[model samples]
Target: MIIEPRIQNPASLLPDAVKAINLLYKAAHSAGVPDSTLELVHLRASQINGCSACVDAGARGARKAGETEERLYAVAVWRETPYFTEAERAALALAEAATRLADRADAVSDDVWAEAARHFDEKELAAIVLWVATTNFFNRINAATRQPAPQTWG
Candidate 1:
């Protein structure tokens, strides 16, 4: 399959996308979202978006970070599973909200935001949003680029 327009690589011609990614990444780390959670969010969002490349990268990253295969497999059905903690559920909700941003102007509704805030502070909330947005961005890039999942992430 031919991946059409490479968004980040031609950033000189698409500065906005690049800048947005840079700022978003910085904000995500600042928001206090842990690396493991961030990776989970990315993987889950990729799953939802059907972005194979992002899913591959996220799953591999999670595994490398010592995330259990049980949890990784349970991510899609997190609401029904016992593998994840309440904190992980909250982040997943935030991820869904961000991934479906176009559906509602305020994709992250007050209730969802509040639920997330109960588990995380302002910085963490920012990180959650950033993580969500960043993963979505990567999904878009990989989807557009037709980037394939590597045989192995190591």
Candidate 2:
């Protein structure tokens, strides 16, 4: 196994950033977006970004929320799987599009946005969007820092 050095202790080196992230997390949970949906979005974005730390953490979070292992494993191929509901699929699509912005000119297309909007109210949609962005933020940081997955995340 190749062990990589973490350059900084982000929580200590950037307390304000950590606080801001905590604030976002709190707001997201309070925004009425379902915990299951938030976990799906976070896992999808982390998978797209190749962030092992976030992926592992997300899996743990999902399990705690009573998500099925089959569904967790199928998040990467959500479109080809029957494990998700229409709303979950829409959230996953939004997560992918938002994470892979460079893959297309219009990253979050109107159709994707419309589909997500169909399943979520304006407040919930806002929370989902923020959740996606926050997950991507953590994904990039972990990828860049070569952060390792925790032995346990429960």
The lDDT for every candidate, in the order shown, is 0.81, 0.89
Clashing pairs in 2: none
Clashes per candidate (backbone, < 3 Å): 3, 0
User: What value does the lDDT take at residue 17 in candidate 1?
Assistant: 74
Top candidate on lDDT is 2
Off by over 4 Å in 1: 1-27, 104-106
lDDT of 1 at 57: 86
Per-residue lDDT over 1-154 for candidate 2, one digit per residue giving the tens place of the 0 to 100 score: 7547477646557889988999999998888878998998999999989988899989989988889999999999999988999999998998899889999999899999999999999999899899999999898888788887866537
lDDT of 1 at 98: 80
- Candidate 1: which pairs clash? 31-123, 31-124, 31-127
Please report the TM-score between candidate 1 and the true structure.
Answer: 0.80
TM-score per candidate:
0.80, 0.94
